[model samples]
Target chain A: MRIARFDDDRMGVVASDDTVVDITDLLEQYDPLDAADLLPDLITHFDELKSELESRSASGGGKSLDDVDLHSPLARPTKIICMIGNYREGTDRPQQIMDIFFKSPEGISGDGDTVILPPHEASIFHHEAEIALVIGKESKDLSRDDAMDAIFGYTVFNDVSARGLGREGINSFLGKSFDTFAGFGPWISTPDEIGELYDQHITVHVDGELRQDYNTSDIERPIDELLAYISSITTLNPGDVICCGTNHQGLGAMQDGDVVVTSVSGIGSFTLNVRDSDARQWQRGVDEEMAARVRAQGQEAPAQGNGG
Target chain B: MRLVLTADDRIGVQTDNGFVDTSSVFDDIRFRTAKDRMPRVLAVFHERRSQLEELAQSGTAEPMPALQAPVPRPPKLIAAFGNYREGMDGDRQKQDLFLESPESVIGPGGTVVLPAHEATIFHHEAELALIVGKRAKDLPADESALDVLAGYSCGIDVSGRGMGRIGPSRIGKSFDTFTPLGPAIVTTDEIADPQKLQVTLTVNGEPRQNYSTDDMEYSVVEILSYVTGFMTLVPGDVLICGTNHQGLGAMQDGDQISMSIEGIGDLQVSVSDPHNRDWQRGIDEEMAARVRNRAGSR
Candidate 1:
């Protein structure tokens, strides 16, 4: 039903005319403690909350979507599990096994937020358009047949990455975990709203130019399989996010002042602006060392690359 | 003062005789009137360190019950990679880092379940842990990185060498119950020097890992400073300093793994097979083939 958290942490639902019906008052009546944090609690009481929201939406008294700022549908997920090398193209490695990694929760930023490009020794930032799932139930050891039921809904995630730092090839955690590296949401779309998730078209655009375009069907492993594999190793709490891997096709780099938009066809879209970080001044010495190393490497510096 | 989280989700403080139910301290008028609002133990230490210390010292004591991971379900759990001398692979000089799943953490007396995958080869790594007390990012030069710490504890970084040998250690070292932390979190005031502490891990009463934090290539302050350069450290976040590889070895099911730091108390955990499990999905013929291929080429 297009549930969202916006404007100073108020829970609401978006209507056909793009107006937001504030459900905070109604939600508090049902359970005050749960109302304080709506997104996570929505996972446990999805049915009840859905019915309550539907009833409230029938009445009026709401605000336009433009009047207020939009926050991430789920802020501070316990974990942001990301799939590495889950797409077939771009590498010669076998696709039989799935590789996974993590992004720190602090890396998350909301829709329309400015993604700070942390100054590093080298500077090559890239945008990865991916389809991400939000867990609805506390899942452990989920089988393939039961995996779909565990998902609360879907959202668009921009897996912002620092390509130069990632070239070390040790691991992607450090390269991908800078603050504001992970961006998602205008709002979450329930699974019922996005029928046949496997066939949805996903795309990424930078400064009005198409960068990444692919169908969910292009993913090496299906959603159910990925969920089953991840849940086997660790428990998936409600509000946890699992970002399905992105295809390497049409991948491109981004720079300061550029606006990047990631969209999933029936679900939704989110836009983020890239800006140079002010915190870089604190690491000038380290940054200078990296610049020196890149300069010594001549024109073949690794910063000139596009994707990981 | 030492703080602990009991198995049933109660906040507690360790006293001279027994444990004190300090959960009530959250409701005290002193904290309420002062607008000191912190949900977890680490946060309390962050916003009101002295007040918390005073409360812990003057609080009532009662008998202790079983304990859980002191800082369970932290927002972030960052670990250093290749930060120790000896037994490390690849470049030994770099300050590599990685993220361990918060869901993998288990409490003292918890069991580290060995997954039933065929390629799994389990190992034990004993290390010291730092509990961050403040929200720090891009640490300023004037600030001492150690000042961001609230307390310290011991953590056993249980790793599976099979998948770790193939790729990054994220998956292999991140199975459920892979990280066992805490009998209790000893306050920073009591620990004179974090680097000089003696650390040891014994399996079935046999010493498998023995080293000093002094042998670490990256000091705790250096690790925190490097980490804060990119990621933000908030209250309740844990930074596990990488382990010394001096006597690393394999662990078997039904073995009691005891990890102890000189100042921090001992944490005892048992190992066992995945309870009533048959086959694992991710670990199959393809995975085995890849591991075999990599091993053969090596």
Candidate 2:
């Protein structure tokens, strides 16, 4: 089943590619405290509501997808855990320690939303395409075997990044957390719906140009182990997102008016317009030079110096 | 007025005598909104401040419920990194900040479970934490910046040293139960001055961090302003002021850690490492010396 949020915080299940069946009425029973609590409430009560949602989807009477404004599937996940260096970036580098970082939950923007580039003196803004895991239930200290069951669904995420802004060329919260920096959705596809999680392709297109192209098979740490390690560090609450790290091979600058579409197979895609009032410019297209540098020297080598 | 949340997620006001459960205010039609009437703290804070104040003033007090973090689930947990001078004569350094996983928060009487990851040491960073009262962005560095503050609380930024030696420190700082905030949120109106407060932390009943907010390189107002310039802050979001590194030390297994800020109450939590790792007890003089040297030079 594909879950979605659209048009003024209304919850729905996407019945078809172009149709969203309204299940917002189904959630009236939960009576969420605030807008932020809506999604979590649905996730919490999903086991009871699942049958009704399926029936409504079968009946199928709702607005066309194009007629509605889509919101991020999860309204306000408490934390967005992002993996660091979880991908090999097409390199032969050894598996390093599995570590994670955070992006502000408020940084989330939905499908077709405008990503406002902060006016900070960032060297460049790049889009890292990856898939995001939506936690199914409250979890902590999860074993690798239990990790698979803890995942509710997967969504396409554009881990929008600001390159070379960290103090002393290191990553900082401010650099990756400007409003709209974390973009995901069209909708979330359940695990059964998104078959072969390890073999799906993730691609990114800026404006009309194809840039990033990678497969989940290249990910250094597989899904279960990654979730297990992160849960050991932090409790994974329902609706919390663990954005699987991206392949930096196709990473390049996203400037004003550029439309970035990040797509993960079976999960669908989300398009966001980049708005940089500063109008800063960089060489357009795939950043192969930096990608090759990462492939050769490793992910840390290219991150050493400030970017242009 | 001080606000507290019970273990069952009820909001209440903690006064001199006891806790006055205010979670029922939402049930009153007059306080109910067309949108939300849920018994959540953020909802109450956003919609029923005046009523909450009234309850704090005259409502009947009852025994406090099993306690929890005052802000059970903040939308954000932003912290200032290295924003304090080591001592009175210490040189001021540039302001830096980072975001910690809000999921890391545990309430008073909670335990800080050190993750199994290998680390040189885990240190407790006691600092003044401000509870944002409203939605704010692009705030300026002036007295008006304080207008956005709802209250203050004691925050312990449990940090893991040497885990991120080659990358960002966020990895080391974001382990579950790393941020312990609470006891209660002493409303801004109750605190005379935010800058002139004493911030201190002790482990196993021994003093480890003792300092004043006055030595901060960037004051609370400036930190709020600087942070808002980039990210929007909402009600119940915690903005922790940086800590003084003078008496910084290690936190380990079976250690009782207590932290307090003047005006706000005390927050005590225990540390337990499943790995049972051990580090030298008391102030880490080598780390303190490094902090002091940097304080003087930079």
TM-score of chain B of each: 0.83, 0.91
Best of the candidates, TM-score: 2
Provide the lDDT at A91 for model 2.
Answer: 73
> Candidate 2 lDDT (Cα, whole model)?
0.80
Give candidate 2's root-mean-square deviation (CA, Å). Answer: 4.0
Residues A20-98 of candidate 2 have per-residue lDDT tens digits of: 9888787788776556666777788889998987777777767888898999898777678888757887677777566
DockQ measured for candidate 1: 0.28
Q: After superposition, how far is residue A95 of candidate 2 from its true place, in Å?
A: 0.7
Q: Number of the top candidate by DockQ?
A: 2
**How do the residues A1-308 of candidate 1 rate in per-residue lDDT, one tens digit apiece?**
67788887788887655788887775555453332356776667777777877766655457887786888887777689998746654334345456588888885788889998876764566688899999999899999999999998898998887755631535545778888888999888888778788888898877777767888876778999999989988889888999998776666666767788889997888889888754332211113343333234322322111100
| lDDT accuracy of residue B162 in candidate 2 | 58
Per-residue error for B14 in candidate 1, Å, reads: 2.2
Q: Residue B294, candidate 2: how far off, in angstroms?
A: 3.7
State, as a TM-score between 0 and 1, how close model 2 is to the true structure.
Answer: 0.90
